[model samples]
Target: MNPNGPLLHFVIAAGLLDSFNPCAIAVLLIFIALMFTLSKNRSAILSMGFVYIMFIFLTYLAIGLGLLKIITIFSIPHLIVKIGAWIVIIVGLWGLKDTLFPGKRNILAIPIGSRQLIASWATKATIPAAAVTGILVGLTEFPCSGAVYIATLTLLSSSTTFLKGLIYLIVYNFMFVLPLIVLLLIAANRMILEKMINLDEMNSDRIRVISALIMIGIGIVILKWFV
Candidate 1:
């Protein structure tokens, strides 16, 4: 199970960085409200988020399978360590860009922006923009698919069963929002959510920029030491 594994903090840190990213934050807040509107207890809220996160893990696992096929060709020594370092830096840069340009979104590619999907339960259907948003954020939030990401790929590749890797990935994802969830509670229910929604655009941008830079710097240190 790799209990007490080194990857624990690394994944948590990456998730945290992503959770706070401008795009990620926007989606997370929306999802929080979405889930709250649907069900409000901590358990219910977490369960809804789990459904969304599991969807992400399902897709990531599929990617892991595809990567397994690709890994064999260059499997002659994977540079898991180096790649992890690179991912850290790239993610940092991505955050830095958004922070500096608060109002603008840097994504240019087709998959860079939001996608629409229909979600249904018991014959009722609604636009599950938030779930889609959550899934997208989970996938792209990695600074760069580095050694950590690759090593995760490598582990999934080597495993006889995929559940092990998938479980780790899921846990890693949940930990990312622990802080924000806590912050939400401390703010006294969704009362302050309105304030978060109404935050001054420029001020919010500057805050994100500074936080993203700090996250990037931490990632560099991770590459240098931990990974």
Candidate 2:
């Protein structure tokens, strides 16, 4: 249960790749736009955004902890790690497919079933409303953005104690939320949302390609280390 270089690398890499997912970015953008319309008060906007991000951080952490427990409880750690490596490889290849074929959606993306719900929840701008939206969005977006998280949890389940896993989960989620915080700050400064949206659109393919490569690298590392 000692932390090692590969384990830490996988955790951090998974978080960073997962954070760049288009679905999460889109929801944050919508929330920011709604916040702008709700009030010109920069302080209030930043405060509500913080609340939203806080909820997101909490929700994701809770899920990671819960998953760690479940994964540890149900199977032998080594077996689970091997299974997880295969899953990561499959998901990595799926990402590669999306990058190569551009129009076809990646299976790892947010599920169609949850997209409408996520969009609906993201429209709320009040602190309570945004907090609830954050929780819901975090849960709902899992299917679309959970590959890295699952892989990291699988890695952790095999190699770390509960407390260490908790600490690593905190680190991973912090990295996950870092980009959203940066985007929120940018939007708070009166930068246009359209520009951000356009930028995402422009770089999305390249992002996918980069994400695919990283996932593949992590998958290979896990496969080699575990299998």
Candidate 3:
């Protein structure tokens, strides 16, 4: 596994930025609720939750590997990354604009429907206890963050092996999941969760804006070295 040294910082920032995302933060709240409902054994719930997240990590690993293979085959890894940078930058700007300008909500995404698909995928995995966890974990791979991750991995494919791609993906997911795991253990109580969810919702738009700016910055970072 390539050390991809200190990409950890970028991935952690990405994860925290992801937490600020409305869907991500809300799903974490939902997971906290599920954690309470799923088991009275805190250890079991936490164990299952980690396993649940591992399952997500593995699934995305497959995706990252596939993307790397495709890019390596095409001999356009850097180009793929550059394209991804543009996409990340644009998505970030759009989210920022949406929050700052209060645009007429032209976006009509179906979050619940997507959640149902995630639920179905989880159930099909045959681990019923992990179903909700799958849904929650899956939601974090939204358009913006997912695009950035995908693009970066694809671009690296030319230089990184398939194993490295998988490793980087694993790192990204670990960092991404850490916050919720820590928070759930410390503040799984309904009052705390509700307060977090409410506060998250109130500031979600601003979070989106900030996340967008970050994405834009990351995009520029990638493009800078290339140019």
Candidate 4:
């Protein structure tokens, strides 16, 4: 077996799971809703959605590449990875608490000010506005869904060459946006879009729990092997 196969599998799986980020999904839904209100043209809505997803993909890819470059340059110590692993675990636990307690405190959310800005951009319902919103959400939603990403980056730093890591980062970001792409496709159908929105709202807490578990598992795996 290729020695790196397990790591590659983990990266793909983490990327898929990370796509369920509540903040990202919420923002996309908000954009979709705003688009519906502003325009009756299906093509225009899809165009905006595509632009939004692409910008998010690009933004996240840039962040991963930048982080990888910094790690390579600084020769980030293994101890830091270990610490990061623990932090990931803690963040996962915090997510669970937030889910169960119904928001006693939510440190993982995008800031309210940033969310308002995103909403304002989304309300514009144009390709350029969507592109900007995507960039903003990509930057701001990290705290809400970054534990898995941090774990993936740590694993990539320790386990792969920089060139290979870059390839994985591209793949990862694509997977991160895959869900949005699906939503964008079905968004042309108002009924289906409404159903999806309702479903997401009903099970959001459950989804959060699942996401938290995955993060904790990834953290443990990193501590065991990669760190």
Best by lDDT: 4
Worst 10 residues of 1 by lDDT: 116-125
In terms of lDDT, which candidate is stronger, 2 or 3?
Answer: 2
- Candidates sorted on TM-score, descending: 4, 2, 3, 1
Q: Which sections of candidate 3 miss by over 4 Å? A: 1-20, 34-48, 102-110, 116-129, 132-140
Prediction 4 TM-score vs. true: 0.91
Better of 1 and 4 by TM-score: 4
* Model 3 C-alpha lDDT per residue in residues 1-227, reported as the tens digit of each score: 42445454555555455544455555556655565654445565556556666665565556666666777777566677678778777877777777677765612122556666654544432345474555455644545356566546654664467776666667666766676677666555657767877877787766667667777777887677542
Error of 2 at 37 (Å): 3.4
What is the C-alpha lDDT profile of model 1 across 1-227, one tens digit per residue? 66666555555665455445454445445565655566566665554555555555455545545655565445433364446446555655675675456444543111333322222220121235435544555455433222234444543344323556566556645654565465445432576666776672445566556555655565566556553
Better of 1 and 4 by lDDT: 4
* TM-scores vs. true structure, each candidate: 0.58, 0.86, 0.77, 0.91
* Candidate 3 accuracy as TM-score: 0.77
lDDT of 4: 0.81
**Which digits, one per residue and each the tens of the lDDT, describe model 4 over residues 1-227?**
14358877777788998887677777787788778887657888888889999999999889889887776664665866786688789998998888888664575567788989998998877778889989998999888888788778877777678998998888888889998899788876677778878987898778778778877887898888776
Ranking by lDDT: 4, 2, 3, 1
Better-scoring candidate (TM-score), 2 or 4? 4
Give one digit per residue, the lDDT tens place, for model 2 in 1-227.
34567667767767877787766787787777776766647788888888888999999999999999999886588788877777767777887787787555675466666766755765665678778888987897776677778888988888888888998899899989999999898877556676886887798767666766666777788788655
Quote the positional error of residue 56 for candidate 2 in Å: 1.3
Instruction: Give the lowest summed-lDDT range of ten residues in model 4.
Output: 1-10
**Which regions of candidate 4 are displaced past 4 Å?**
1-4
